[model samples]
Target: MASTLHDVARLAGVSIKTVSNVINDYPHVRPATRERVEQAIAELGYTPNLTARSLRSGRTGAIALAVPELGLSYFAELAASVIEAAEEAGVVVLVEQTGGDRDRELELLRSPRLKMTDGLIFSPLGMGQDDVDRLDVPYPLVVLGERIFDGPADHVTMRNIEAARAATEFLLRTGRRRIAIVGAHEGEVIGSAGLRLRGYREALDAAGVPFDESIIGYTTLWHRSNGARCMRELLDRGAEFDAVFGLNDTLALGAMRVLQEAGLRVPGDVAVVGFDDLDEARYSIPSLTTIDPGREWIAATAVRTLLERIEHPDAEQPARLLLADFRIAERESAGAALDSASAALESAGAILHQGAGADA
Candidate 1:
């Protein structure tokens, strides 16, 4: 026989209403009481009648997560983290791919399918800041990504400018001057490309390095293919660069591949660095040094915020912009000059010692 809500309430020493509140993830439920109810549910294997509950509560116990493209590694990883966080709250997630088209993103905002979910977490790529008015919808919404700021929703994103500056400064510290950039969009203002480029410029200015426009590679997309294409373009232009910074890891990996394919040895010919610190970044040849932009935290916080919005739809909580802290992951790609020098000395010493012993 299946355990009923009444049985869970008895075991938890709470009213049926309290049990229901906890099951529905109501925010006001006391922490201790919520724990007790959760433990009771675990002990008795109680499952709520979601179909009946939906009819009574008018919530589907699900949320919609929209991203530009799952083909991009960053978005894919972010979606995975979102799914994990949603599961912990005992809710389901429906993911949508917008392909980063402006029309598609705007249409999704007014889609009737949103009624099937409690709320939405949107990461727009094609929409600009001027389209902020489109976000003035009647549903609970949380915005993600570095696009369309000052919108009418709670925004969650990583610190792009600071992190990008850090990455650029790191490359400069490694004895690499005349660094080139991959993934620059033409006339981008507040988008990720522009913000990150701004950070790179800040770092260069701080380091007293002159900014050269010729080394900037332009690309509309941040895909691996785009990275490769940008790198080829830079090469074709005969740009003189000692280092390369890919806006994201996928782009970095693609650029690195092209560099190697063109007979330019990584770290020996030109050092490379990237952002987003995606999982693949660590395993690549001459593992990429990149930024760890609190991605998991962003996903967890976004899910929790959306859940809270659903829990208190009328609460007077002001829309807030939360920035995730970021750090640089040191790896082989950001080659250490001192380490290479030390290695070279040790190798020469070993060779000399072997020759002396053989002569003796």
Candidate 2:
């Protein structure tokens, strides 16, 4: 038979209520008392019955994570990270995929299944500012993405505009003019697509480079397929471009493949850069220069925030906004030639030094 709460309470020389308090992470419990309770629970191998606990506290030992699509590498990685963090907190996670469709996303917001979990971590792609009011539901919630800022919940997101600006400026500093941007939203003004496009324009404007609308490729999705299709369309239009900036690493890899199919050498004919420092980005042919947008931090923080809200409901909910720090992952795609030339120069200089040492 498994050890019970009574066993933990008896071993700790405390009442069952005190043991329950400690298990629930009640802040008012004294440190020494909490430690004794924890040690007792550990020694007795007592695992609290989640169903019984739920009946008493009305909180399931699970949380919900709803994302647009886990098929995307970035989201898949994020979901894994969230699950890891939640496990550390002694909680289970229930994941839901919205397919990035507006109807499905909205329907999920009103999901009866939400009541089964303690809270939700939502990363919405379809809902916008107009749907902010609808998020004022009963459950504790943390919102992700740039679709609706200043919403009535804790928000965690990457600094898309700032990161995008840094990526575009990097390409410009590499002496790549006539840079074409893949994964642009046609009329979006607040989402990731729009924010990144705005950033690219800012970089070009700062460098005194004229913005050519013809060079911007529009896509409804940010998938690899969308990137390839958009690149092909751009090529057919016969627009001149010296480099491609993909909004995400997947898109960048797709565009790189299509560029190669057209017999253009990467970084020789057209340098390539991307966002999202995915695991696959490092293994792509020529490797990809991309942005590491602090994804792990975002995942950990989102889980932590949701748990805090769930555990401390009476605590002031101040609609906190968190942005992930971003850095460029320099790789072979954009600066391969420059790196190879530097390596050759170093080798030549080493040979010259060896000869000089021999003469001496």
Candidate 3:
């Protein structure tokens, strides 16, 4: 037999209505009374019947989260953060992965399975600006990622251009002039790769450093294997680069591994930097200096915004474009070590030797 709401009320010496108020999170409940009710519920090991509560509230007390791929560290961490935030709000999260396929993403938008939850938080990768109309769903939907902006739903994403610019500027300030880029998509202009590549170009233009296309490595995916392959190609082509900027940490780590295999010292032969401050980035060899793109805030904001939409479906609030602030996580991969006098001398000596037609 399971303890009921009446048992909780009896243990707390309160009315059934009072216990219900606390469980339902009514804002007017007195602190002492709410605490007493909560303590009693804990003591009795009472669990609220979600089905019964849903009958009265007309809400399933659950939300759906759809992402491109959980195998990717950034998406994996984002999902974990979303789950944490939903758990804190006493809501359940059903996760779905689309493998970054456009057709699957469109199908997910129209899927009848979404009726099980009150709202959805979607992160699409394969679907681009062309699929913007598909986002006008009839539910409380919050869209994440760098795709299909200004749609009919609330959007939560990072400032990719500004953050990528900051990352590039950081490398330049470290006395690196010939910076190579990994994980670039060929002829792209709207996705993450395009936006971030634009930022890198902006930084170079501001610093009066001419962009070198030869050192720009193109990849179809942002995976470690792609990063390694890109770096190898750049090396084989004899692209002269003093620093490498990987679009993401996984790619950066992969490129760094390849650089080591080629007997090049990181930050000594070629300083390295990456984006997406993943937890694994902190534990990698020499650690990764990357961008902390406020993924946790994005998750929390997405949940809160979705809940607001769910609570006030007819409130006529216009869709919002919420952008998360980002900062560079300075670590060993491209840290103060590069600013040392010896490193500065080494870079200057290499440049001087090259100018004098001498082998470095």
lDDT of 2 by residue, 299-334 (tens): 888998899999899897577888777777777788
Cand. 2 Cα-lDDT = 0.86
Write down the RMSD of all candidates, one decimal each: 10.8, 9.3, 8.3
Error of 3 at 264 (Å): 0.5
TM-score of 1: 0.82
Itemize residue pairs with steric clashes in candidate 3.
none
Clash list (residue pairs), candidate 2 = none
C-alpha TM-scores of all predictions: 0.82, 0.82, 0.83
Model 1 CA deviation exceeding 4 Å by range: 1-48, 338-360
Mind giving the per-residue lDDT tens digits that candidate 3 earns over 125-168? 98999899989998999999887888999988888888888888
Better of 1 and 3 by lDDT: 3
**What does candidate 1's lDDT look like per residue over 139-213, in tens digits?**
899999988888889998888888888788777766678999999888886988999999999999999999999
C-alpha lDDT of all candidate models, in order:
0.87, 0.86, 0.88
**Which candidate achieves the best lDDT against the true structure?**
3
lDDT value for candidate 3? 0.88
Off by over 4 Å in 2: 1-48, 337-360
| lDDT score, candidate 2, position 9 | 94
